[model samples]
Target: MWFTAGLLMAGAVVGNAVLIGQMSGREPVLVLARDVAWGQPVSGDDVKTVDLPVEVGAFAVREVAQAGIVGQVAGRNLHAGDLLAPDDLAAQAVPGPGQWVLGLRLEPGRYPARGLAPNDPIAVHPAPDEGVSSGSGTQQSGQEFPARVVHVSPPDADGAITADVLIPESTAPAAVEAAVGGAQVSLLGPPQK
Candidate 1:
């Protein structure tokens, strides 16, 4: 009986040690806050946790120096240990080759669509030039196209904010030339497919 009890105690000790080791080996996931900066400590319940591969351990959030958390969105601050959603990490994915990227300059100094966020579907509307007025003296029918807002830029002198528009490769060339060559290109949200 004494020998059996000793063996059981030893097994328990080994089991507890293994459990502790496994727990210690587990790495904490980095969570990013929408407005927190890289390397900043996360406060309250702002972080989400997820398992990551050992190869990506360097990107893991460590207890010390918690600012390793990075925001998935550009132009926004990210905090450490904040659980990142798909959108948070979407920026890391590279666009497909052959995809057309067009820059739409927003009107100067106006935030008419400040609420526009990246990945938002938008429609492109090209205001007909005044010189293209119809016989009735009104501008020609405005050209409208569909696009996705891949990015938004700060305001610039042209009184327009530049948006990086992604469109099909086949239509990119004409769309870009028309927009950049002073033809109005209004961007609309993605059309319901």
Candidate 2:
């Protein structure tokens, strides 16, 4: 009697395991292969497939659903390894190869209280009247360089913000110069996207 009961319990455990496996909604999904910046194109090279439970997240795009991605643009900065979602793509910008994207740190006094928003046109200039000294210990000044804000970090404990800007390659050197020389970037308002 004891042997029969043990065998029945083992059989029930195995049967339950098989039933759970069948119900486990594991599925294949296409997630970001790498960090795709704001407005970048979504191509096959930017995605990869992996099996995940059915309830991944809202807007999750499946691997088989990638046919609609090739020409679509990233609506915002897509971090590496994030699950690709439908709303993440749109008929928005695809940053050209000639656009240079970079970051700059700015203090509360240096940038506007309203702050820069993504895709907002901006101009980089050495913070006016700063009289800052450079690496050579000589006073340095910089001029405005046209650019667009790609992303803006929320203020830290001290209220400083870091902004990522995209500018034409032809003017990247000047933008870097202005930033490194203590620049202040002006947010022109109204995001382009």
Candidate 3:
């Protein structure tokens, strides 16, 4: 009984020492202090730093990079407590020159059930009810224009989602015409390389 007790004590001490050694090499990284909407600027108060094991720290936004990240637009919907990653920010404003931002008020079933986030690739189709006629005098419902989502809001009391999309200059006129009646947005797969 005495030998068995000594063996258990030694094992506990060795296990604790190993755990402490693994946790000792930590570095500070940025984590969100609050929820940040897509396209919204990141402020100093929006993030806080915490020490994490070096392995995870290697891929996280370093505490030193906070200055550069501040005032930058969020590339996605960053939830509170989310670890800041380099890809989580956009370096420039959305809808660069020659692009127009269009607001799409979509009802449930009109958009993907899974929901949308910033920078999501999408294709906008003319609402069939809108009866937009093409140059050939045919309805434009079958045509889709490529667009990128700038921001998407949660469903409101009426279950309507408001998505702001970046439309190319050439397609902005047609998109606006379609949006005046309503539009159906389809989430596309990840952009190809």
Candidate 4:
């Protein structure tokens, strides 16, 4: 009887241990709290920790890794509830030195609506029918400075697409002045090759 009772007790203990192990929850991981635009900084309020299965969150950024997420710019447009990861963040501008960061407000016809994204190269030109000087003096309608595409804001109330572009400082003032002087500036297309 004593041996039988001991074996029963041992079985019960082992059974309890197995049950506890199986009932344990998965690790908590960081997920986006709201939609974030490209190049926007991530703050503590921008993320939340949630329990996710090991297999699902294995490649995700864990809650422990959320500490350094602040000040990191979004590498792409991030939707709400997205699983945060290292590749989703960037260190701001990747443009070369002495480049100008300028905002260009474009109407629907001025810039391409498809396949355009950040980090793409752009060619500058005078908007169609605007013969105002493009600062290059001779190449009035030809390509201007080779610029880098940055953030592209959603269409505003006026249906204009606002974009942040990086161009050489040498041509920055002249290009902006022309735009301000009622001379239309259009980014024709991404540089070929």
RMSD of each: 9.8, 9.0, 3.9, 7.0
lDDT of 4: 0.70
Cα lDDT of model 1 by residue, 1-193, tens digit: 9999999999999999998876666665545434443222334345555555444555545433333433333323444544453333323332446666687765643224444555556666554565677778887634455666566676666656677766667766556654664433333443588
Please, what are the lDDT tens digits per residue for candidate 3 over residues 7-99?
A: 999999999999889778888999999998777889999999999999998888999999999989888889899899999999776666898
Clashes of 1: 27
The models' CA-based lDDT, in order, is 0.53, 0.78, 0.85, 0.70
Ranking of all candidate structures by their lDDT, best first: 3, 2, 4, 1
TM-scores of the models, in the order given: 0.49, 0.49, 0.72, 0.62
Candidate 1 vs candidate 4: which has greater lDDT? 4
Say which candidate scores most in lDDT.
Answer: 3
| Worst-scoring 10-residue span by lDDT in model 3 | 126-135
lDDT of 4 by residue, 41-134 (tens): 8888889998887787787889988888887888877788999988998876444477777877766666765724665666655443356555
Q: Which whole-number lDDT from 0 to 100 does residue 186 have in model 1? A: 38
For residues 112-153, write the lDDT of model 2, one tens digit per residue: 778877667787876544556777777666657888787788
Q: For candidate 3, what is the TM-score?
A: 0.72
Please provide the root mean square deviation of candidate 1 (C-alpha atoms, Å): 9.8
Candidate 2 vs. true structure, TM-score: 0.49
